[model samples]
Target: MYVAVKGGERAIEASYRLLDAARRGDPAVPELQVGQLQQQMRLLVDRVMAEASLHDPELAALALKQAQGDAIEAVFLLRAYRSTLPRFGYGEPLDTARMRASRRICAVFKDVPGGQVLGATHDYTQRLLDFGLLCPDAGHAVIQAASGAPVPDAMPSALAALAAEGLIEPQRPSAGDPEPPDITRVPPSYPLPRTARLQMLARGDEGWVLGMAYSTQRGYANTHPFAGEVRVGHVPVEIVPDELGFPIEIGEVELTECQMINQFTGSADVAPQFTRGYGLAFGRSERKTMAVSLVDRVMRADEFGEDRTSPSQDQEFVLPHSDNVEASGFVQHLKLPHYVTFESELQLIRALREAWDARTTVPPRSVEPSTKEVCAK
Candidate 1:
């Protein structure tokens, strides 16, 4: 009997069809609309947008739909789509101080000026599974109350407050004709420019950044960082129209910013001053922002009079490895084709084994015994 070997092309085609079928299950079950996914799964959409560095919610929603809810895949799709888009102009630096905050909290103070607005968070939500959500009868009520309280406006940041009280040293933006380095356009060089550090954290992996941040809490570094401020909201992004030669509001982007105040141990002859660690990202990614802040502080060991023993202190280690897309692609590429290298190793092992066995089993010829027998004859 003869059998035909199948190639990968047919299998790949079949997989695509099966994936399509699986993504769009039962005809009776109403398909999940993009709007529903955008509204209901806003958190996932936010993360995808943050990591992908694309601010368009509608595009992100479409990518989510196309990827069948795979977030990383959705980010990849969004990034690819974003690359094809023409760059009309660059937006003005978003002003976080002007952000319309939905949530704001500070760990350092018991009662801050803004009163810790815990807007929309899952922090206090019960972890128990809600099976009732599966049932159609689990209806919810809507409340219509007369508008009573006026929403509060933007308040002073904690760092600014500290500076006002003279508790911390003031930071001055660069004076004179110094131009800040653009991280997106250029590769980073060490000792990294502050602008490069901010950009890296903005686009860094959430989980990895969180881990690096948590490492400092677990004694990786000695600086005790307090969450000076965490704010989440939308900020207007503006673009300078060339013809108009003035800044115009192009669009808005939701952002999360964390400013951490760390205790500094001053060296001899230097007065101790509280240091600043700043983190800002493009979305409501509070945890990522917080992590970035910690990593930021940890990265400033040399300036803060600390030794660089920890992994977080190593700029080359932390900054380069923070990106997930680059890391994941490089790591996953190992699965492709390495058989030739493995085969070479296998041949070497076999040769070594044969040589060892031959040396052990074979003996030297007895030329002395043969000469003695000949002499006796």
Candidate 2:
């Protein structure tokens, strides 16, 4: 019997060798440097960092090279590497109010405190490609520094204005000295709190988050939301040392923050007030932050006493499937050997068919046996 099976260990080794050769196509062409990918392909590096939940650009760049520019695979690599690192103490919660912003925009207000510094955005760019970019020089944008007085160091949050007017829900100070939940330490469970949900979405696949957000806009758990503010900037990271009682600034990290205001439903004690959804992520991840904010609002349907009939609103569905790594691993496992189980199924089907045929078909009467038995008698 000729039993078919996939290639052995030697074949697997050859496949890996082939993959490496293919990754470095054309020996005449210089191999892409990690620095080039980090600097020139910054957006991709940023996406990888965000998805991997690791903020190291250098690591992300290296992962990108290893993964051959597959963003999801790069993220997986970075995440795998991150799991091997030693743990340091957690940093205090970030305060975006004190952020030194590189980009800030408010859709609710025409003009904001910082005057909407539109830094390196493609919002107004045309969809048509400029073939000129094929030339290296064409890729560079003109650099001109503004010769003017410095802008304010801080800007008032657009949400603050609405909250002051009693139009939006009031922001409450944290009660008790509570540490922020770390999903990396403990696995998430049912009825996830807002913090865990935000953490999951921040590190979730961009496409999955975007799709869920889009579903809400398309009337699945519809809640009309306005982009109250979107800001990308650097903020100081503070950590309180166990040896020292007070906190100290460890470093600064670039972050994108989104605040969304949604339609109001009147509560028993309070009049109708616009609800708020918040999202914050490492790097200039505007799209991810925006999607996170929208989805965050939908996930809060239960807390708001709204109907939880939609897929996005169901925490059970969204939280588990949001993780790209787990989902991809399970899905990709289909390629693994299933011949034993399949063979069992094949036998069952054959047996069922045989029984059906036996039940339906009338067996030819044992005429020969009857004639023989009559002769014997």
User: Looking at candidate 2, what is the lDDT of residue 104?
Assistant: 87
Candidates' C-alpha lDDT: 0.79, 0.85
Model 2 clash tally, residue pairs = 0
List the candidate 2 regions with Cα displacement exceeding 4 Å.
1-7, 144-151, 173-178, 359-377
Worst 10 residues of 2 by lDDT: 139-148
Q: Model 2 reaches what TM-score against the true structure?
A: 0.90
| Model 2 deviation from the true structure expressed as Cα RMSD, one decimal place | 5.5
- Tens-place lDDT per residue, model 1, 1-377, is 11124565676678799998988989799998999888778888888888788887788888899889987778778877877888876777677788878888888887777678887787888998888779864634312432333446676676677788766757666446266776656788888866688778777778878888888999988878888889988788888988999898877778899989987757785567678888987767888888988998888787656887788877778887977767877887776656678899999999999999988996777666677788999
Candidate 2 lDDT by residue in tens digits, 306-349: 88878989888887898898888889778776889899999999
